[model samples]
Target: AVAFCESVQPLEAVVSLMAQRLALAEDVARYKWNQKVEIEDSAREQMIITKLKAQAVAEGLPEAWSETFFKAQIAASKATQKQLFAEWQQHHAAAFEGVPDLNSQTRPKLYALMSELITALHQAWQPLQQPECQPVVDKLVREKLAKPGYKVAGEPLFAVH
Candidate 1:
């Protein structure tokens, strides 16, 4: 019989971190809106992917899986930013004051979250291969994320399922 811990799952923590990371999009969108910068930063996204891919091995994650995962996350983040931008535009929103500096404040928080994610993904690697993975992923995305873009980000964790 499966142990109690085996029956339980830690995927919620992963989805929570994903939601937290996506939440940063509002601050990013505000900063971009004020600075007149495009939401899509190909160079920065590539750099993040490259850096994370390098660290994936050390974190006990497959490089290719990490690439796909982070790419999905970047896409989700960009989608959220664009949605906010469109909403603000429709309302003729004024320049938002008190926006946190994207460089120092927002990026640091993202980096810390990424660090935590690396650790969690390492722990979830085996569990992600189980047949139960798809249902858990669907449920967690529905509960924790509950956003259209997030549905794309939260997909089959491994090819096994």
Candidate 2:
């Protein structure tokens, strides 16, 4: 089952990145709200997806698989942002102070996470095809609940089967 564990390792990285991205979304929502910018940036999202597709091709990963994984991450981030904004609106919250620049600060960090995720995917891609992959991933996620603030959003991409 070493291969199973190896396959699931990348998924753990993906989950870690997802949690971090969700946390970052709070700051992003604050900045957007204060700046009168919309939370949903379709152009930016598409640009990132396009970049991911190209990177996937370069890395020998299936473009469709990588795109689907990245799309899930984007969806989760947007959902968190929307929820935070709605909560702020309900409370009539004041503008956040010392908000960071989205393009310069936030996006760079997200890009780094994306790079790490891609590397992990490249490492785990073949092992993910093993029959034991899904069960091992599920177990790891369950084990992760012992850590505070650890969460699994939806299912791991390789766990679909």
Candidate 3:
């Protein structure tokens, strides 16, 4: 994950720089055109500045905030997974209601499968943020895996069914 963050850092930097340059160019063009700086022009320029600054801030945000974003995303994904897992548990239990034992191993495995999906999602989405979320994401992944029955496979944690 750290390696991935490092790799994306340069890409994000380039993207930010390009965006800033574009904003600056637009401003310069407008100024050069000198079409009478009216209220509308001021508003437009303000909008551009806002956008550029947002991009810059996103690119330059502290690593901790990026981590929080990652963790929050992970938490959201996990919550969804947990919900699906519960639904699976109910349906499967009902399906084999009369059965003595309907694959005890599958339940836990399903949970773990969902966890793995979220982990992969985090890895894939982490780069979307200008800053890196690797450190927090990595820690959060481990913390999630530590949960009991998370490693076991059972009903398939995802709703792919």
In terms of lDDT, the best-performing candidate is: 1
lDDT at 140, model 3 = 35
Comparison by lDDT, 1 against 3, better one: 1
Question: Per-residue alpha-carbon lDDT of model 2 for 68-144, expressed as tens digits?
Answer: 77777777677777777878889999998998988899889888878777787676665566666666655654554
Instruction: State the local distance difference test value for candidate 2.
Output: 0.70
Off by over 4 Å in 2: 1-8, 139-156, 159-161
TM-score of each: 0.90, 0.80, 0.24
Which regions of candidate 3 deviate over 4 angstroms?
1-58, 93-161
In candidate 1, what are the lDDT values of residues 1-161, reduced to their tens digit? 54322533567778888889888888998999999899998998898889988887787787878888888888888889988998999999999999999999998888788778878777777667766565676677878764657866776353532
Q: Could you give the candidate ranking by lDDT, starting with the highest? A: 1, 2, 3
lDDT of each: 0.79, 0.70, 0.34
Q: Candidate 3: lDDT over CA atoms?
A: 0.34
Report how far off residue 79 is in candidate 3 (Å).
0.6
Sorted by TM-score, highest first, which candidate order results?
Answer: 1, 2, 3
- Across 15-56, the per-residue lDDT of candidate 3 in tens digits comes to 232222222222322332233222123454344344433443
Model 1 segments more than 4 A misplaced: 1-9, 156-161
